[model samples]
Target: MLNQIIELVADELNLDSKTLTKETRLQEDLNVDSLDVVELVMKLEEEFNIEVTDEQAASLKTIEDILNFVEANK
Candidate 1:
């Protein structure tokens, strides 16, 4: 699941999956802006068949956060 999330994020961001780590921050590390984050959330929902609320999306700061959320919710 972690690997899948990393791949999805990397593809969406046009980045190398190998460059992403659990500690990678969505904004600071990945340079993800608000629009990108919204798109990412949409992609994640489509991929995982889950609904991520605005509050939950706002709380995701790092790759690990996303992973943990998906693990818990998926």
Candidate 2:
């Protein structure tokens, strides 16, 4: 599941999979903007069939955060 999320985000962001890891900062390393984050979350919600609260959404700062969230929710 972590790998799949990473793959999906990497593909959407046009980032190299090698450069993306659980600890990678989504905005800092991937150059994702606010809009990109929103889109990414939406995609994740759809793909994982989980709802992300606004607060949870706001707290997502890194790939690890996303991975943890998905694991916890799923």
Candidate 3:
């Protein structure tokens, strides 16, 4: 699941997978802005088949947060 999430985010963001980790901050570390967050959440919803609320998306500050959300919600 971690690898899948990393690959999904890396491909979506056009980033190297090696640079991504659980601690990677979406905004600061990866330059993910509000639009990116929205887009990412959309992709995540598609890939994971789970809905992400706007508030939940806002609370995702790191890769670990996303992983946890999917793990719990899925």
- For 1-74, candidate 1 gives per-residue lDDT tens digits of 88999999999999999999999999999889999999999999999999999999999999999999999999
Model 1: worst 10 consecutive residues (lDDT sum)? 28-37
| Candidate 1, position 6, lDDT | 98
Clash tally for model 3 = 0
RMSD of each: 0.5, 1.0, 0.6
Q: Candidate 2 overall Cα lDDT vs. reference?
A: 0.87
The better-scoring model by lDDT among 1 and 2 is: 1
Q: Write the per-residue lDDT of candidate 2 for residues 14-46, one digit (tens) a residue.
A: 877877888998877777888888888899899
Model 1, TM vs. native = 0.97
Per-model clash counts, in order, read 0, 0, 0
Q: Rank the candidates by TM-score, best first.
A: 1, 3, 2
lDDT values for all models:
0.95, 0.87, 0.94
lDDT of 3 by residue, 1-74 (tens): 99899998999899999989989999888989889999999999999999999999999999999999999999
Best by TM-score: 1
Q: If candidate 2 were superposed on the true structure by all CA atoms, what would the RMSD be?
A: 1.0
Residue pairs with clashing backbones, model 2: none
